[model samples]
Target: MPSEESEVVVVGAGQAGVAMSEHLGAHGIPHVVLERHRIAERWRSERWDSLVANGPAWHDRFPGLEFPDTAPDAFASKEEVADYFVAYAEKIDAPIRCGVEVTSVRRHTHRPGFRVETSDGTIDARFVVAATGPFQRPVIPPVVPDGAVPVQIHSSGYRNPEQLPEGAVLVVGAGSSGVQIADELCRSGRRVFLSVGPHDRPPREYRGRDFCWWLGVLGLWDLETPPQGAEHVTIAVSGARGGHTVDFRALAADGIELVGMTRSYEDGVLRFAPDLAANIALGDGKYLALLRAADAYVERNGLAFPEEPEAHVLGPDPDCVTDPRLELDLAAAGVTSIVWATGFATDYSWLEVDAFGENGRPDQRRGVSREPGVYFLGLPWLSRRGSSFIWGVWHDARYVADHITIQRGYLAHGTTDRPGLTPASGNN
Candidate 1:
């Protein structure tokens, strides 16, 4: 309200949004980043007490900075990462309006600006960057029966393993989130049980170098099969879901018991289907698809690949999914804790746009929306494999910011032809 016109309005001051904030600052762009909570508050508040980032500290840092060598290979705890982000904000002086919740964004029919509404008030801006990460919405399956227990929580809500109930804890979803939590629990002398589902494979070192380097080379973050669509079916890479990660191996090392995928849960009991590998198969297929895609891309781009991968392609968790049935007596086990790291859902209700196809995602290329001046960043594989992750944000941010800068420069210099200047996105 104070200024009827502004340069840009960015939503969500997390990793993605914050990266944009830094780039905008470097160019002296007068923009505001609207965040519901303090910068990186989610990392500080939501992660498990003992949880460290799965990736090492070297690759996990945000743009414009690096973690001290003292930081562990696993990176510091969630709290440390949060603190680093907070410190980053201060150094960059990103214009962040913390505690301001964004409600909606609608276009101004008369101009290039968008009318953005927030908890405090509304503003109009010429451009918008949705740095909001894709996992804003948590995916909770609806297979649970009524009154299963009083303490059901998603991985997002879990801050410490001590919060879970005592006895044999049954963790659902064998993805990285679930597996990591299970590893933590078992390592801490807790008898943990994990409901094995479809999962990703593990890699030794990606290519001839570290695994992170390989992810960059393969364009994992850059590759995305629309969550749904023809792209979902045809372009969907098998390796998308289950790329190399520490899952079953970690479980084996930690001595955690793996359970079959639960088909249904009722009356404090979880039931498994006859086919056990059903879930595991899905996970494997996605991972394989991704690996194949990466291989094809390397071949297509004429990029040389290293010799064969040293790691073996893991098949399934110890508990085979081919069996007919099994059950988990949560009540009897006195199991208290459950971590659902299965995956995420996109809740874009606040974004009113017709561009979103049936898949509920705005059809765009490289964050350039079908709608003018509306851009997206930090989406998983938005341009390439690392696009949304810490190591990748800077690359994407520079492209978008440079494009914006060029556009501004062009307009100022009185260019006769007005081309839609977008950031140059090279998946290098």
Candidate 2:
């Protein structure tokens, strides 16, 4: 196959890829964005039909565009989010080619650049930016016994309640997605059994403001530290009713049976760990710590915000852990569906180069990979917590675009450390 050349080649046409392409465009830098499917394919198809943004639309803006006429506090639907990216790409004239899957990206041995192998052809680009967002593959645990359930679906495959089986549903992993799915199932008059996990549950509204608003004000998005250990606690939130709280307690109150952590599924039976109380306490502790940290930031910064009122109905009592039936017979319980809302995995197998660390993730400092001319974006804590969000990648995208432009001259002419090679300056 013939090879096409560009100044920069970005993989994945999601929010991060679009942002990177936009910045490169703005800077008069030549680049092309390659997508495996249509633009924003994940948002277009992976999410449930009734899904909406966990955060308000106003805060989800890219650098040069905002969801026009969207209320500051209103949440956007998945389709709208997907459409926004399409419109943004058109607005910025992003050089994006859809249905082009990148097979591999490796450094050019004979040149100061990279050779990107794609389904369409090969791309000989001076720089390559991997904007494939953090969640590349859905992670359903192997403990889920095969053929134990009649129907098994990952949360990404779930669409709406009407699409599910007629009986009860078992939702594993009680993070934001799990809770939201359970809530929808309960509201749809389906019995929902939610397996609880240690996840953060910030109240939807706190001290007369949205929790996300407080997070923004308190600079939680600016947090640079990644979650320690294998258990990375994701934000447990919901975009239902514009924006609301979705937690295990709320799900339980909504008639969804709260169960302990899932252990194993064998012989038509599902088993749960007996650590229900401990899990609830762990989640509540994290929630309380978040509130305290926000308050501390306000006090230290001397920022004037509404004073937090006396504790109200924040969450369910931690000790109110119900010792429900730990072992559930799949057939006897009439549980016809299982939705695995169990997080995702970062797959860099297509990169075709050794760039990961002991953690099996790219060993990069803020998107600047160790491999010359190779970069990464749209990763959690790539620079800050926001790096994985829609509004956040602009920072890292701008930085990477700048880096690419700075090294463009050197890559083209085999020059090194030559002074006064300023990047193509445009909007910052």
Candidate 3:
């Protein structure tokens, strides 16, 4: 088939796909967005009620919809963010084909068209955008001590305190989700033990500036304006999670017991790493320094303090405590539940496409891949800073949408496959 007879297909209508679809609609580009599930279903299904966006209500919002107005420093609940996404989908109509699960994509060497086979039907498209963001997969390390006393559950499967096991529960991993789950479990009066690992942290506010303000000034959240020669570095910096990035310190102040990293969960006791505190401190200090720098920048810029930043330091505390311990040995620690707030993994198995690399991740530079017109958006390190942020996908999508438009224009002028639209691997 010729490219002129095809449409553009976008896969995965999560945050990334939604942004791509909105841009395509804005550009009058004819594209259909295929989502395996309804919009915002992941957040609703995978997160608990107390789970909130890691960033403040402002930065957490996706394009086209503002979070429901709440306290200035409040965290937007998962439901609120989900509702916002739902509204965003409707606002754009976005040409979304709900329940369409794409099975495979094969590029044509004869033309710049892809035979995209989906559950609904096969549609040939001149281009395909794999906007499936990260967190599509969950990683559960099987380091649990054999015959451990707790019920193990991945973060994705946890919904409420009741779902957690009895006694002092161990919440591993200190990412946003980890700490949040710890706080929730503790609030529900469960004796909770937290295993803090290396994760980013940032203050909600710094030096009288809203968290986003410093991000804008230091060019953190200024994702639209890409800096020169800083592609990889910028992504790395943006992805850094600081203590200020989360409220673990506050949770600690609230009396949540913190422990060193679990070296191994054998003998019923989660053996502590001798340098676990050092590891936690290193990860924590980097983020703290970032928060301080943002605050310093606010002062240097001479901007009127927008909000009074809280600069109080947490009091020195014990390095580790084995409290909430059930058994004197490991089994009696009474800790029966283990919630792995570790994180998610990316799954691309359903993509029967021929455009993946050896790592199974779509082999793409930013959005453009060697696989002809196959593109992927909202991937970390895809391009420039925050390529996966709510504000970042526009740049990547525009680049891809422009490419598709060029292909369409060529096809409009009676050009079939000038130079023969060969796949990267030269398959038809």
Candidate 4:
């Protein structure tokens, strides 16, 4: 294999990698971005056909680069989002190598930096950025036994209602993806059952502003972590059908059956947790909390935003919450397909560094790792709540780039006074 060298090697040419390259180039840093496929490959391929970005175009993009002719509040479709990234890479002249996959990264045995092994060749660099964002791996829980459903697919594999087998469908997971898919399937005339779970239900638009806009103005996007006891809760909001508030009551009223969290499947029977009512209550509490915060902010600032009474209304509990079905016979229910929208997992097995904690996640402050030249990007809560968002990735990339520049400067000046490069820390 051929060998090359650069000051930095960025693994993954998605938003984080591209942003990193842009900021690094601006700092006169020599680096190369390696991607397994085309830029924004996940956005182009992994997402379902009808998917749109969760945030509005104006807020979801990198600074100064608008989605072409897109409405400020409109959520860009998956293709449009991917194309925007491709265009951004081109405009920045990013040194990205498509089709090059990083197989492994480890400390160089005979050098001070690191060695990155790739499908194409080897690259020795002083710093390595694991810009592989989250969603590296799809997590389909083993709740269903083998051959339990005639057809099964993760949310990533889902394309459209037409791609599914003709019958009732069960979407197991009530996150944004699960709810959106369930709604789509139901509207397409297929009987749909949504396996509800712990989630935060926020109105898509509130008080004449998008929920994302409210988060931004309220500084909630910068929250370092989830509120107590709500760490594992997913947000159940949607950009589908021109964006609307996600109300389980409304979904149930519209003919989509709602059920409790799935527990297991065996002998053609599926079991569910009896926490449907509790889960709905949890989400409602979060929603009300958000509304109260917004209302308080408005009162404090004396902003004359019209009061939304509907935002405070929680419609009657659907049957799923009032008297939930704890079990179902798959065959009797005629469910032929199952879509697992249970979320994603990270794969850092290729990284041969002691940067991960006991939880198997990178232990880093911001993007800086204890492992000297290694850094992580595009993980949720890396620096803030929005760290994994498109615009958030750019901010994080700039921070990482600035940190790298400072480290290089220290080395050039023969100084180890910086906190990350202190002599006792072993880099010296």
Q: Which has the greatest TM-score?
A: 4
**Candidate 2 clashing pairs, residues 3+ apart or interchain:** none
lDDT of 2: 0.81
TM per candidate comes to 0.78, 0.91, 0.82, 0.96
lDDT of 4 by residue, 1-428 (tens): 99888888899999999999999999998889999999999998998999998888989999958999679989899999999999999999999999988888889675478878999998878899999999999999988876888899999999999998899999999989999999999999999999999999887888889999899999999998777877667889888878888998988998988889999888999999998888888888988998999999999999999999878988688776799999989999999999999999999999999899989989999999989989999998889988999999999999999999888876666434554443311232
256 Cα displacement, candidate 4 (Å)? 1.2
lDDT, candidates in the order shown = 0.66, 0.81, 0.67, 0.89
Clash count, one per candidate: 25, 0, 20, 0
Superposed model 3: Cα runs more than 4 Å off: 1-6, 68-74, 145-147, 222-253, 306-314, 321-330, 352-357, 410-428
141-224 per-residue lDDT for model 1 (tens digits): 887743576566788887666777665676777755677677667876888777765445434234444455556656454565
Stretches > 4 Å off in candidate 2: 294-320, 412-428
Q: Between the candidate structures 2 and 4, which one is better when assessed by TM-score?
A: 4
Candidate 3 per-residue lDDT, tens place, 1-428, comes to 21222367888877788888877787787788888888867878877766666565556666566776645455666777677777888888887877878887776544657778777777777678888887788877877854576578888888889876567788877766777678778878987778776555555556655555566678765454344543322110111122143544456667676776666655555665554456456556755677677657767878676544345454454534323222223456678888887776677775555667887777777688877667888877577566776666766777777776676665566334556444322134
- Scored by lDDT, the top model is 4
Model 3 TM-score relative to the real fold = 0.82
What clash count does candidate 2 reach? 0
Candidate 2 C-alpha lDDT tens digits along 1-428: 77777778899999999999988987888788999999999997999988888888878778577787568788888888899999999998999999999998888765456778989898887778899988899998887676777788999999999998699999998777888888888898998888887777777776667777777887777888866852377667887867775556656676888788899878888899887777777777777777787778778888787876543345544333655658989899999999999989988898876667878889898899887778999988899878888888978899888887777654445233555432322101
